[model samples]
Target: MSAPAAALDWAQGVWDWAAANWYYPDEPGRGIRPRLIEHIRLSYASIAIGLLLAVPLGLACVRWKPLYPPLLTGVNVLYAVPSIALFFLLLPYTGFSDWTAIVPLAVYTLVILLPNVVDGLHQVPDHVRQAAVAMGFGPLRRLVRVETPVALPVIIAGLRVASVATISMVSVASLVGLGGLGRLILSDGFRRQFDAPIVVGVVLVVLLAFATDALLVLAQRLLTPWARRDRPRTGSVRRRRAAATAAADAPALASTAVAPPGKG
Candidate 1:
């Protein structure tokens, strides 16, 4: 067979295998449904835990600006550590259970999220902070009501990144037997040399990352209506440009008209 023909046949076989094995509705707790749920559970759990830890630390860093340098450095160091290496480091202490997976996942999330939280809060406009203070708002009230809302766009952006990272890393956890959908890829696909399972796992992970990122974007929009309201539309921009050109030409046209067509 030609190379292209061989590749096509192989793809067809993989698709057929996936279609046949994708679901197991009849078998209790043994198919796509459970695997998908498990994957989502692990991803969200790690993100939630990371939020609980990172947010406070981020706030603290914002409160004490000098601490930010060292704090960020430390987290970056942790972030640079290989996920697999971190997994092994924790395995002895936490064993092969879900904690081992969850801990590293959460730390990775925290590493990404902490800087975002701090930067978001810091990005709040000075005028806005002054207004809050002028209104007799205390520090805590200003933080919660004024700062957090304004900063949410950046914070949620960080979360979108962290959530995707967590999903991808969770797949690596399968090597230690704590994988969710990753089990299908590493355990079933690699061991059996099956393309379908690996393809399905990768496709699902990609879809989940997109879904999570999109949802966070929606949340950011909803939370920051002022931002959307301030954005200029494409039509409005074109109209504004046309108006400016007309205004700029008006003086030149007037000058030319009175200048006595002497040049002509």
Candidate 2:
């Protein structure tokens, strides 16, 4: 057979394997579906926990600006450590369990999220804070009603990035026995020399990341409807700038048009 025909046969075989092994209720938690679910749980749980921790920490940093730099340096140190090392370090305390995976992932999420959260709060204009204060809005109320609203776009953007990163990182958890889809790639696929599971696992991981990001974007739209509206279109902004430039130079042009040309 030709190379193309051989390749086609291999692909068909992989597809057959996928169809046969996609779900295995008889095994009670060993198949692709179960692994995928575990992956989702790991990814979302870490992100949720990180968001909870990072928000308050971010607020505290904002309230006390000096804390921001040191806090960031610390998280950066955590971020710099290898994921596997983090897992091994926690293995004693959170040994052989999901918490081992989750604890480190959450910390990683916090590392990514903290800066964005701080920056998001900083994005809130000083004038807006002054207005809120003028209206007798308390600190908490101003944060919830005004500051948070302004910050949502940035926070949500960070969430999008962190969610994707966490999803990809979950594959690493398979090293400690919670690989999710990664088990298919690193365990059976590598051990058995099967190509299908590896391909399917990679494709599924990508799909999950895309799906999570899309959901976050939808949530962002729902939560910050004004963000989209407030964003200026590139063309419109260019037009406005061009018009302003013309207006600014209008008097100069007018004077030039009226004045006699200077001899060179």
Candidate 3:
């Protein structure tokens, strides 16, 4: 068969698999919904834990600049380690449980979140920090009330990245027998040489990443309303348009203005 024809056939096969497995009338285990739930559950839990562990340390890093280089290098090294290798290494200690998966994923999240968070805090204007100090705010209070709020946008951006990465890694965790959409892809498609499950898995992972990122963006906009103030509001845009329209009509109105005949 021609290459295009073969690719088309493979795609069709994948679609067929999805049609069969994506829904469940009686068999919950085989349905897409359960697998999706598992995927989201693992991904969210890992990142949430990671955020708790990283944020305080990240804040500390802003206060202690000397620690930044060594700490950054260590996390970067952890980030460079392969997921499968980390999973296997942890398996002996964690003993083939979800922790083996979750721990490594959480660590990966820390790698992404820590730097962004510290950088965010560092980026807070010196003037702003000074103003807080002048106003009698303590370091802790200043960090919580003044610094964290301003740093939220950058922190949230890091969260978006970490969330997407966690979701992708969670799928791969299925290789070690933890159940997620990855299980379906690896077991049905890759293992058995089926096409549909593989395609569905790949598509779902991409969609999940985008969906998670978009949600984080929405959260960022909500949490940081001040940032949105720079964006033109609908009412303001309409008023500007109305003002321009009236200005454009002014010259025409003046040209057509009537005067008393022969009065001059």
Q: How many residue pairs clash in each candidate?
A: 0, 1, 1
Task: Please write out the lDDT profile of model 1 over residues 1-264, one tens digit for every residue.
Answer: 899999999888877877776678788567555677778888889999998998889888887889999988997788777778888899989998778888888988898789789989989999989999999999888888888888886777678777877887788888787778888898779999877788888888889878876676567656765654333655687675565445433433443344212110
**Runs in model 2 with CA error above 4 Å?**
2-4, 230-264
* Each candidate: RMSD: 14.2, 13.5, 15.9
User: What TM-score would each prediction reach against the true structure?
Assistant: 0.80, 0.84, 0.81
Q: Tell me, by lDDT, which candidate is best.
A: 2
lDDT of 2: 0.81
Clashing pairs in 1: none
Per-residue lDDT value at 243 in model 1: 59
Please report, as a residue range, the 10-residue window in candidate 1 with the lowest summed lDDT.
Answer: 255-264
Off by over 4 Å in 1: 1-9, 25-29, 229-264
Model 2, position 11, has a per-residue lDDT of 88
Candidate 2 weakest ten by summed lDDT: 255-264
What is the TM-score of candidate 2?
0.84
Candidate 3 lDDT tens digits, 143-224:
9999999998778867876777788788778867764888878887788987677778879988997888668766875788
